[model samples]
Target: MNTIKTIAARAFLISAGAIFYINPAWALLPIQHWTEPSGAQVYLVESPVIPMVDVQIDFDAGSRRDPAGQSGLASAVANMASKGVMAAGGDAALHENALGEAWADLGASFEANADRDALHYTLRSLTDPALLDKAARLAARQIGEPSWPADVWPRDRARWAASLKEADTRPGTVAAHAFAAAVYGSHPYGARTTEETLQRIGVADMQAFHQRHIAACRAKVSIVGAVTRAQAQTLVATLLARLPASADCATPLPPVGEISALTAPAEQDIPFASAQAHVLIGQPGFARRDPDFIALLVGNHILGGGGFVSRLTNEVREKRGLSYSVYSYFAAGLHAGAFTVGLQTRPDQAREAVQVSRDVIARFVAEGPTEAELRAAKDNLIGGFALRIDSNKKLLGNVANIAWNDLPLTYLDDWTKKVEALTVADVRAAMARKLQPGRMVTVVVGGQR
Candidate 1:
């Protein structure tokens, strides 16, 4: 009987192509949302097609919230969360080893990531009742009671410091660091890890940060897969209840101020030994909830985000062969983000490449996308939308973002319609309003000084 069940599962998966592909025009699966009694926001999508579950929990505790002079504190703490935690007052290393064995036995995958605005913890496990329970318990402990093992701190901190030092040597890294610093002077967004800052980090610091920032009030939990509403409610409650109900000790992160309008274009060049020059351009862009976001999204596809079909690629790469690739995007955050165009070119052609890229952008901003380009972008976006949410894991990521950004529940449902309604005029007008070529910052690494 067991062998028959296993064969049936494999056959079903093979026939169904692993995931049920939804038509781009269909409404996205409904998200069941509620707040746990512990104050964590919960979003769920019941998917019974596969006997698996994915859970992602996010906290507003990213590097942006790190204290002054503590550049890498948040990242270090996030990394250490999985190393070892005090569970049941036993040896931390032994506890972590056992937990690892348990996950291996249950075929669970776990990960933690920290970015500028949030820290994310994710778990994927089979929905077998016993297996699910163990995975959830392990995740809860990692979230609520990080042990911050004394012995593990030195090794983790050293590894992080070494990685940062290595990254600083790369020209692309140099350009990115210089660009972010120039764009966000004195803001926490400009924070970068250094040997000095890493030295200041310690296990105690991580413990304190965890206490203050990893509270239920700051959490947004997203769950997807084979689970009932009652099961989801119980699971989330069990997980989040381990965390503090409120941020009693956290110093609130200040809102990022608007970028001041540039009177003239800002330029920076860092000499490096390389055959190709790495270049970056543009200025501050809209927040996540900016009304012009959809228009800008559609327009950027024409400008550069649409791969070989983009204007930047057509002019810079295909037309003149100045570079192999060039692209632009808006890195929207909780606060004002950046719009950037980036590329690499032969050292001697760096100046010309920047000029051509800027010219392409200026033209696009002045006239917007052509009717054909607008239509192509919308069609491509709408057509590819289904792949974005075709799997349980992918859908969980989208649901998490929606919950974190406080977007309307209908955001996913309305995505295609929004893109479809955008006109050439809308794209042109939005680009002209949001992007200013004259005020942009330019950074080049690895060309003549």
Candidate 2:
């Protein structure tokens, strides 16, 4: 059978155009949570509508945890994991080809990736006991026994570095690197992977980094799909069984210090030959843990995040026709991440576009969204809230986010209520507290006077 046929046959045999009705109560579904014996935090949302299950395990070993000068270690470790697994305890090692075939045969998939804030392993498998049991065992082997294949890193590293080299030649890449450096300063978030950094990493380094960080205690596991609390518990145990136990759960990963504030306005006009100028503006914003999250979320939508309807787009893109798109976002994470406003414009109108965008932001921060804007933003956001958790993957992401940020279980259910309750004054107050328009960093690339 082809992949699609096999997946349906294995996971669930239903209609071709199956209408799986997700009960509205599912949005308010209680997130079942518990701590595994290994001290890993577990969050589960039971959706019996389908026979497939989605699982994600997060660890505090993202790029932020990379050692100084080893900028891409976490990513490298994650990528190297699928190359193969080392042999352990009577099961002869499976080569990469064998491993791929095993997963395909079982009609399941596993993936690993490192993001700015964390490393994640996600598995999607049928709830069929036969398929799920084998998938779990195979995933465990990949997670706990990544071979860091000696032959793989050198070839991968060469390709990676060459790609980075090619990317550096692009104007957007140049602008982004500069913007990150300016906003983040000496923080790890500013660190970029370079050919030199890759040279510092090797197979041994990946092995060492994985051993040091991939402990059971640091994992926050999120599950959504067809599984009971008991089954999830067992699954969690089985998946993490081969991982090194946490040495100390109470003592957290040493805090990577927060991004410092911009004390003075810094402006850079990078000369490039590109046709359109890339302009980036703003400074560090709030953290995920900040109580002002809801206010900021709503406020940002009115400011620039809400497309076509935002103040920034209206002011910078609509009226003057300076650029096709203008937007802003808060990269809130474990610490205060960057609040970035960006757009591209004709080289001649770069300065004007930049000024207009900044003016809009300053006004928004000072005066907040107008009552009409607030009403519209709320209506739009609240109306679309259901779509956020409409599917298994989306719900899994919400649960994982809730788990990662240590949010209350009712956070999703209460999301709309909070958004609706927000007043223009509330958005203004939060924006005022978190932003200072004057002290922002302004970057203009490929722009001329």
Candidate 3:
């Protein structure tokens, strides 16, 4: 294992009437793991570097699990969860005010977000014993006792619908929605929030979705910073214990259907009034545990993931000056996600930009990265690994991903070794096997339809 050098002397700090030791070398921090009686998996990294603790709790309760025709139910639930809970013993407004006051007194930060495969609630608080206790209890109450208050539903729904309306007017948003619908077809992954779908959602729908999906069995907790093993365990257990102790949360999501091979390249053109045309290209990519994950990750960096040094930038931005920015990425999700290359350029230049990007991708798939490019990618990835987990917040996010995806505990520890072992041939073989340029779907918004 590659170990980061440790500090010869630890520094001491004082905050809020408490003394704490800061570890300068946090790269080697170990993740401690365990399970609660309620079947919630917990991963903790005890770091005393800061007198703060960060907790992230995730459940398999995102939009992918939404009932047919209720596309935004999960997002609605996530948004309302922090607003109020039944444990506060009041109506929606009262409970919301009470929770806000409680969090203010404890000086804690809380956030919730929903994506395709999961819903997450994150909390950050000073690790002073009193503050930590209060924060943890409040977080638990919010998670386990969401009220989904009926009184607030209309207002919240209106706000969400209005936001969607605004987003729909943007060319990039229109293109993205169209691209997803075209790429995934009837798969649940293709579902996007529309005015029609949002109108169909009721508070009862959100409540039912929460009850069926956010159970203890599907929870994953990640805690980091200024806490002991016992404290972390208790924190996670307390938060999740109130959830339904069922064997499973809900029926498993159906597999995303494979993208049909393209007979002719697919394209969608949406006319809009904008200075530049927004373009999106490519197709379904890979899942979290794809065998070619590491290779794809490294290869993507060389191709487009690396900011200014990427081939996409070299071709579209640096050489031809087609756009100010161009990039590509494989969005790995619970199922096969999209591998997309996106850029915005002058209306007249949009088609040429797309062609240039495609040419770059085709050549990359055919020839792969050079020996020097592969070495640079590995060195950059390995050398920068420390920065990725240097902070407690960063480590907590990584741990949450590992837990949610059922990745090996040593995933972080083994990351360097895996990248170091990659060769030009590995990247070539993986890209060749996974990417098919001829079958990619392309979407352009803002140009002539």
Best by lDDT: 2
- Superposed Cα deviation of residue 371, candidate 3 (Å): 1.3
Give all candidate RMSDs, comma-separated.
Answer: 3.3, 2.0, 6.0
Candidate 2 ranges beyond 4 A from true positions:
1-12, 15-19, 246-251
Q: Compose the digit string of candidate 3's lDDT tens values, residues 28-95.
A: 67778887777678888888757788999898788887888889988988988876788444424337
Clashing pairs in 3: none
Better of 1 and 2 by lDDT: 2
Better of 2 and 3 by TM-score: 2
TM-score, model 3 to reference = 0.90
The best candidate in terms of TM-score = 2
- TM-score, cand. 2 vs. native: 0.96
Which residue window of length 10 is worst by lDDT in model 2?
10-19
Deviation in Å, model 3, residue 29 alpha carbon = 2.4
Who is ahead in lDDT, 1 or 3?
1
lDDT of 2 by residue, 1-449 (tens): 36544654745554212336665566788899999888889999998877778999999899999999999999999997788987896767987888888787777899999988999999998887777887898899988988777887899999999999999988889999999999999999899999999999988888888887898888899999889999999999989987866455566678788789999999999999999999999898988979999999999999999999999999988898999999999999987889999999999999899999988999999899889999999999999888888888899999999999999899998999999999888899999999999999999999987
Per-model clash counts, in order, read: 0, 0, 0
What are the runs in model 1 whose C-alpha is more than 4 Å off? Answer: 1-27, 89-95, 245-263
Among all windows of 10 consecutive residues in model 1, the one with the lowest summed lDDT is 18-27
lDDT of 2 at 311: 94
